[model samples]
Target: MRLGIIGVGHLASALVKGVLRTGFLTAENIVLAPRGHSAQLRAQFGCTIAEDNAGLVNACDTVLLAVRPQDAVAAVSGLPWRSDQIVLSACAGVSIADLAPYVQAAQVVRIMPTIAAQFGESATLVYPALPQLAPLLAALGKSYELKSEDHFEVGSVSAAIFGWAQALIGASSDWSSDKGMDRAQARALIAQTFISAGTMVAKTDEPVSQLLDSLATPGGITEAGLKHLENTAAIEAWNGAADAALGKLEKRR
Candidate 1:
């Protein structure tokens, strides 16, 4: 399917790269509306650059609205959208009701994807769970069709954890390097650890507490770290970060 992307920011750029990498869409079939880092994207992906939003929408059947939440209304309102186009929005916290008046499309889907999308590993969340968009979303990563806008908002908050996860890995790597480990090796090892953890969590149906119990044997090193982490309030701090992110998303329409 021909794709048109408005707002060529980092996340949208990752989606474009992932789709192309997976051969879901060819460069010739995609057009990007110029915005932040658009020139670099056009050069890197060999995709067409539309002079304006209307131009972009006019050139494709599917349009991805990737503008920031605050800019979504204005950006889409100014565009001349076709009634047949499937408008999939990646703007955080912006619901279908907030976007419908501006887009005026027959189909609108809200989506949330992480930076992992660049490698086709993102957990993409779609609202209203339209079957038509499933294949395309799945091409980018794991596709979840949420039943309601409320569910999509919750998914967005969850997706924000990817950023925090990267930070945690970086912090771990820094600690390792400070103890005389090679910085590059430390980063690679920490990345592998995260990858392995994710794989285990995804593959196992066991409760996390049960999994932790398996690792945190009495007087073991895992138990020691768990105690230290609990004493340091690490888990509570992460929960607080999630709450803060949800608070911002909840404030949006």
Candidate 2:
């Protein structure tokens, strides 16, 4: 597949690296719009740099729309798109219907992939998922097929966790340092803990609550810690954050 990346920013760059690393596409088949950051991608991966967005679009069958949500319309609206071309949008809050007029393509799919995609570990989400797109999605990372636009928007609520997870890591690092642990060590240890937890979640079939129960044996340290967190309403605080984020997304609809 010949692919064109309209906005070669951080996320798009990661995706480019991932797809290349996974053998989803080759340097010869990929082209990117001319941007300051595009130079780095060209240097690192030898991806073709197009003279402009239109030039990139003309040369590729699949166009990845990675522009910022506010700039999406202006960026793709004037592009000379073909009816046979596929447009995959990575911009948040912009639905396929929202992008139809701008892209005017036969296929418009919305995707949400995290920065982890750069490392070939992103948990990507696709809306109005089609069977044909599975291979591309699989090459990037784990893919979830949401059946409707509403489901896709709601699925996006999980994206807020990147910031929240970083905040948590920072707080935990601070707590560890306050207890006389080395700050760098604390950071690495906590980061690894999250990674291990995520791996376990992916491998296990049991409910998360079952895992929690297994970890917190009666009268054990884990149980005590869990009780303390519960008393402080830590879980509720996380829910509140998720609710607030979901509310903002709902407002966009």
Candidate 3:
């Protein structure tokens, strides 16, 4: 497939690296619009750089729209979109309805992928799952297909949670370092701990509560920490943060 990327920002760059690393698409088959990190990507990966958005649209069978939500419509407006082409948008809070007028006959699909795409570890979210996108999504990382646009919007909040997870990892790492642990070792350990925890949940058939209960034995360190977190209402605070993020996304719509 001839893949084109209109926005070459951080997430877009990560995706390009991921798709290439996975051998899902070669550099020769990828085309980048002439803006943002397009030149850098072309220099690094030998991908073609289009002279303009129209040229990029004309050249590729699929275009990834990664521009900011506010710029999405403007960026795609008047473009030479084809009925057979697909426009996969990663612009958060921009609905498919908002893009329909500009894209004309091209099919628009909304997507949310974290920066972890660079390492093929993104928990990408897709709305109205398209069978043709399965391989591409698999190349990026594990994908969660939403049943509807509303569910997709709710799932998109996880993109913010991804950043929050990084922040939590950093804070835990710093705490370890402050207590005299080697910074690099502490960071690696804490990050891997999170990965192990997530992997267990993903692979295990047991309910999440049961899994947690197994670890948090009475009077154990895990139980002590869980008690402290409960006393501090940490879980509630985390939920509040998610609610706020969802609110912001809804507000943008």
Q: For this target, which candidate reaches the highest lDDT against the unseen true structure? A: 3
In candidate 3, stretches whose alpha carbon ends up further than 4 angstroms from where it belongs are none
TM-score of each: 0.96, 0.92, 0.98
lDDT of 3 by residue, 1-253 (tens): 8999998899899999999999999999999988999889988999999989999999999999999999999999999999999999999989999999899999999999998887899999998688999999988999999998888889999999999999999999999999999999999999999999999999989999999999998999999999999999999999999999898888778
Error of 1 at 37 (Å): 2.4
Candidate structures ordered by lDDT, highest first: 3, 1, 2
**Weakest 10 consecutive residues of candidate 2 by summed lDDT:** 97-106
Candidate 1 to native Cα RMSD, angstroms: 1.3
Candidate 3's C-alpha lDDT?
0.93
TM-score result, candidate 1: 0.96
Counting only residues 3 or more apart in sequence or on different chains, how many pairs clash (N, Cα, C under 3 Å) in candidate 1? Answer: 0
Candidate 2 vs candidate 3: the lDDT winner is 3
Give per-residue lDDT, candidate 3, residue 173.
Answer: 100
lDDT of 2 at 191: 90
